[model samples]
Target chain A: MQIIIDPYSWLLGLAGGLLIGLSAALLLIGSGRIAGISGIAGNLLFERGPDRGWRALFVLGLILAPLIVGWLRPELRAAAPTVNAGMIVVAGLLVGFGTRLGSGCTSGHGICGISRLSPRSLLATATFMAAGFVTVYLIRHLPGLA
Target chain B: MKNLIGLLAGLLFGAGLTIGGMVQPQKVLGFLDLAGVWDPSLAFVMGGGLLVAFPAFALARRRDRPLFDLAFQIPTRNDIDKRLIVGAVLFGVGWGIAGYCPGPAIAALSALHPATLLFCVAMVAGMWLQRRLMR
Candidate 1:
């Protein structure tokens, strides 16, 4: 349960953000798609046939890259955070629902949406941020959940 | 060529999440817990992201067409509609409860957090449900 304090964490964050923005920009630039997770995941799940290969690969890369990094750098590995299976499931379901209802997730609205200066995305991102703020308040302050 | 760029971008993003300590839910929780013993580190993380992104976006805007091609696909809607408000509230609730948003949640897998797997599963299910109900 020891958290390693490393200066590299900042560099990583910056680099990651750039990658996300760049990827999003590239996706918009190259392909005519928004790099939204809900849209991508939805297409992967429901859409039929060969066209899904890239989406699958995009997701697969998302899963596999971490393992590769962990293999290369042992120090990068840290104790996994604790949470129960039920909580994780519930949280996921909520996120799924929210993403759908909102028509995008953070990547779509927060990253892509904000970048494009879409008023809807700006509103959506603001809403997402506000929701995150409230959720943190309830979890930390409310008696039962903590 | 485009797909390759997208893939590389995703890999860099995934790596960034791992290196940034963003893959850890606790770190995110700490960032969100503003009133308590909060970790202000995420602010720096966000600030760092904005530092790069703000300028990059500004530069992108100046161009008539993006480097790859075409104008940026900006969404046109602006209404503070019910769907927008309700969806945001739900998203916030999930985030508050779990401390893992979609991007970070997917990225957290590199850290190999078991919770992320569950989160992903549920996230897919949520998408499914929305498709069923709304459509």
Candidate 2:
């Protein structure tokens, strides 16, 4: 098998990863809140709480941040979504519901929780990664699937 | 001040996702496709994040209260239940299929990506359904 390595990816990934860590750290150090997008967004809709205002603001920033970047660097615009509408819907529903039931998403459980040394986060991360690997394998390699 | 800080955190997180290639569905899918071309760039991203986060968490643990808040609000639950595993599996399946995790999906909506609106709507609906049925 051939292994492809892209230096640009490694550089950008590291830089971006640092930024993500910084952001999560900022949230923790500043307001003591976890940078869990699902918990923030879902709670805004499903449950009313005092933190709702800040959560909404954070979500708004998330929606606006990309536009701000694209304004400064048009070339950095995100890639288009090519998956069919049906497939996207199914995926979206699963993500929303699953994250809720599981109590976190990648940002929450994968990044923040693990960083906090939570055992539940460790298990959740391992399970999700395994499932993701299997799902990708089945979708990409199985005959007539892709 | 807290709201402002939260907004900044969100902005930084969104920028990180975009810069890390997570906002692009193809890149995410590429990372997941281990049997194919197999892009391991995302692993580097995770590693980089963890490197900084580990120290940041240490700082957090030493503090009784956050800089701008009254107290820390971390999750204390340690039990790993069936719901957790099942939900994680379902979330992973969705992620594998769409290459859009929760954060990046919401972040991509800023770009007006064609499918994002429907996906977000469905995602919100799913959340609503879970709240009603799961409780």
Superposed on the true chain A, the predicted chain A of model 2 yields a TM-score of 0.92
lDDT of 1 at A62: 62
Give the root-mean-square deviation of each candidate in angstroms: 3.7, 1.2
For candidate 1, lDDT tens digit of each residue in B16-117? 555556667787777677666666556555555455555566666676665564556545677768887688778777876787777667766655556677
lDDT of 2 by residue, A1-146 (tens): 24459988888888878988988889989999899888988988878768988888888888778787777767656665568999899999999999998888888988888898899888888888888888989998998987
Report lDDT (Cα) of residue A24, candidate 2.
89
Model 2 lDDT vs. the true structure?
Answer: 0.85
| Maximum-DockQ candidate | 2
Compared with the true structure, model 2 gives a TM-score of: 0.96
Across all candidates, the chain A TM-score values are 0.82, 0.92
| CA error at residue A118 for candidate 1, angstroms | 2.2
Q: What digit string (tens of lDDT, one per residue) describes model 1 on residues A29-129?
A: 55545677676777778889653766776776666666677678765543343667887788888888988798787777777667667777788878877
Q: Give one digit per residue, the lDDT tens place, for model 2 in B45-73.
A: 78777877878889989989999989999
Candidate 2 residue B61 Cα shift, in angstroms, is 1.2
TM-scores of all models?
0.83, 0.96
